[model samples]
Target: MSAWHRPSSRRDLFRFAASAAACAALPGLARANQRPEAFTSGEIVENGHRFFGSISRGLAEGLEQANKKWGRPNAYILGQEAGGAFVGGLRYGEGKMFTRNAGQKPVFWQGPSIGLDAGADGDRTMMLVYNLPDVEAIYRRYAGVNGSAYLVGGLGFTALNNEEVVVMPVRAGLGARLGLALSYLKFTPDSTWNPF
Candidate 1:
């Protein structure tokens, strides 16, 4: 062989393959860091119906109606929560947060409430998040208003707002529910029993 020519070996092939793989992954990594664009109401409605089945019809309609006022959401969370209340209430849930341009991230949320509330209810919830600048923006305590009636069919919905981000929680479940309460949800990176 000449000085400028060398036979390619298995080691060289492996190195080339590894380099190509890393290069291909760079775009995905970069995209993961970027904020996602707003998603359509139809997309969220479809997902809700698919996940919750027959009961989701009311929730979908509620979201569609709210979409007229809130516009499209930048992200959404699909999760289930079960909790009971006797004056003071506590709830916990886990789900995946989907962004339009970026991928999904696992999320856990827990919260406490106090007011004229009493119930033992378990519900599947789809939360539409609006004006979210980034995924990390969701990791905060969102304050809930006392008497924002967002109900449809057998399902009920509530709107929780904290400045620019608006979270509309659509729920389908059972139990004697009444009155309103001051509540807040804390979205954490991991599941925790602590509600504070």
Candidate 2:
């Protein structure tokens, strides 16, 4: 082959293998750096938690009538699911992440979703539940259910043009107060009947 298009040699293959091995170990290294009891022992480290709490209170107050009408608010829950950066879309990535593990229960709650999008990179979303009734229902179901459940990600607080999910944009900066950006959504009873 010409110098412009030469076939890779065995030395090149070895170098490629070494790089691949190192790259593959990165995720393992990241996990190893994490203390096993970080969540149990530490206070809220991510700003996302503050927003979640505030939104929960708002939903409880704003959607009171809807909560009473439903009589059983089982879909919205106030809990945290450890999420990592994903490929494809957020929903698909979240579903894949949940399905990968065994004995995981699903919770369905919609409030405000905050996400960041850097150029050419996939977005990471943080969702907050405004309705306490919905939050309680999700919590109870997760606690009682033994098997895994499917999780749908990102029910934006505001529906886009009355169709798409509403997304509250979060700017990327160093500790620039984010919890204040929580958006309120009007609670509407889901028409589909869920067995759970």
Candidate 3:
């Protein structure tokens, strides 16, 4: 056998430990204060939108409407007031870690799992439709009302800023899949364009 390798010195070991701790704290710190005060409508229209594997603004708009039907407490483009619209999108960074596809793996198999996805933007853009009604419908349609929904996780319908809505991410992983199904539900004021 060869001579055992040392970590250079105690100082080096401490440095590694410090670095690991710093890295572990980074994600939680980044997600903190992610909530925004307002977003604009023009930004949604100008920016490219994709939905359910389709690149159609109409569908996205429709989804927004559905979210509203269920009482989307906050809705707007990227720069408008954050309330009124049910669906809201925020800037997201690539390499961000989120539980997206964890259930598929055999090792710990937690059902649809979470993962770190890499893409544009230093922070990942989060699009949340604050509507519980639509979410319930989605669960019924996709996985049947009587039976439990697919492995996609639930945000546990909760109240945010006096509004009942579900949080959803735009990424194409499991979170987005469940959100996509939720988008198919109908919305109130049904104008198709800034109905609220």
What are the Cα lDDT values of the candidates? Answer: 0.79, 0.27, 0.28
Model 2's TM-score against the true structure: 0.21
lDDT of 1 at 52: 80
Cα RMSD of all models vs. native, in order, equals 4.3, 18.7, 17.9
For model 3, the superposed segments whose C-alpha errors exceed 4 Å read 1-35, 50-54, 70-126, 129-165, 169-196
Give TM-scores for every candidate, taking all chains together and pairing residue i with residue i: 0.80, 0.21, 0.25
Q: What tens digits encode model 2's per-residue C-alpha lDDT throughout 59-150?
A: 33323433243232211212322222112111111211011112223443223222331112122333222222211122221111011112
Model 1, stretches more than 4 Å misplaced? 1-26, 146-153
Q: How big is the positional error of residue 98 in model 2, measured in Å on the Cα after superposition?
A: 14
Residue 61 lDDT (model 2): 39
Against the true structure, whose lDDT is highest? Answer: 1
Model 3's lDDT to the true fold?
0.28
lDDT of 3 by residue, 1-196 (tens): 7654446889978987897799999875554324322223333334425222233354356446645555332332111011111132222112211111111111100011122221211111233434323212212111101111223321112111223334333322223212211112112211122211
Which sequence of candidate numbers ranks them by TM-score, best first? 1, 3, 2
Ranking by lDDT: 1, 3, 2
